[model samples]
Target: MRLSVIAKVLALPVVFFVCFFLVPLSVVLMSSLWVQNQLSFEHYLTILLDQYHWSVIWVTIKLGIYSTLICALLGYPLAWFMIRIVSTPLWRRLLVILLIVPLFTSNIVRSFGWMVLLGRTGFINETLQNMGLIERPIRFLGTELGILIGLVYILLPFMVISVGASISRIDRSLEYASRDLGAGHWETFRYISLPLTLPGLAAGSIMVFALSVSAYVTPALLSGGRVTVLPMLIYQQYSTVFNFSYGGALSIVLLLATLFLVAFANRLGSTKGGDK
Candidate 1:
């Protein structure tokens, strides 16, 4: 009776999941292949055969990786500070509010902010000019550097929130245990705390990487059509060119790539726990 109940309980969710998630995804997969009187690899083959498309894919991946790295480097310390160093709850809440303000804002607005700051008459250029740091205002908008900055700004909160949760959840006794054993702060962090936080870091990294790779708005606005990304290509195919099969193939490519990365990160995170 108990086994029957358990199976029935599981079956309901499985049905719901299939209806909601799997079915829609299946539609896309099927559509990606519906070309020229049969299912075929022509769509995917077209994606791979183009050198320029490959270059765009490479650029997108590189930008995602770079932005994720920057987020980790900056977010770790900020997370640590917010969770550990800030003893007052009110102050911590205020800091968290400030961190989230940017996240709550739309990507268009955020990228526009960057557009202003990076433009010729903007604060960054004006400061440089006043200090005689550069004879001419450097170009940031409509460039890879501009896109990178916008991406980093947009995705940084994912890193901070995930890492902060991990930092907050860490048992303080672990640090005390290390200190009791005559370990200094650096050694304690290196050997004990950091290892425990690996899962959180991995989680944050995956979020940043996936979002950065698939991001459209920030790149579209900041790149100013000068720099092309995978999302931009997909958007163009679906929106402008009206080539659904091509867009579907691109969507599948991004989805599979993201799934591969999540699997790889999960494996690494599991191994990280074993190391402790």
Candidate 2:
């Protein structure tokens, strides 16, 4: 009776996952493998043999790597500023609210905001011109730079929050100990603070990287079709081509690539920590 009651309590989430997550995934897997009632890898083979497909996949991965690295470089300082530098709770709360407000808004709205800011006649170009930085409005829209900017903006808050939480949880005594050891600020940060924050950094990197890889709207809206990516290709196959098999194969490829990178990063992190 105890076991039965326990299983019944756990049943709700299991059933929910099965009905929602597993069921839809199973449907897609079946469609991808099934053709004329026989299982096949033909759809996957089609994608594997295509150069255009490989190029898009590479672009997506490259964009993700660049975005994540930039977010970390920028976010670390911002996290440090929020945690160590900010003394007042009100300002910190306000800054956190500002960060979250952008996240709460839809991607379409954020991409649209970038669309306005990155245009040839946009605010960025106008400011550069006024400062005599350029004779002409540099082309940002429908370019890789524009897409990257949008991706970074959309993904940065994740890094900040992750690192911030980690920073907040850090024992202040650790810093005091390092300082009392006659360590310089850079030495303290390099040796003591940074190593402790690695977990949060890794978590943030994975989150940003995965999201950047699968992002469609930012790339689609910013690229203006000049650039192509795996997610956009998947969208095209599903929406315009209506080829569920090919779309499923593409989706699987993206999923696998993301999983592989995340696993590698996690393993690398663990190894580094263990060695330390």
In candidate 2, stretches whose alpha carbon ends up further than 4 angstroms from where it belongs are 1-9
**What are the lDDT scores of the predictions, listed in order?**
0.91, 0.93
Q: Candidate 1 residues 31-85, lDDT tens each?
A: 8998876898898998889898789888888898899999999999999999999
In model 1, the runs with Cα more than 4 Å from the true position are 1-16, 268-276
TM-score of each candidate structure, all chains considered together: 0.92, 0.95
- Candidate 2: how large is its RMSD? 1.6
Per-residue lDDT of 146-260 in model 2, one digit per residue for the tens? 9999999999999999999988888989989999999999999899889889889889999999999999999999999999989999999999999888898888889999999
Q: Give the Å error, residue 221, model 2.
A: 0.5
For model 1 the local lDDT of residue 131 reads: 99
The TM-score of predicted model 2 comes to 0.95
State the lDDT at 117 in candidate 2: 94
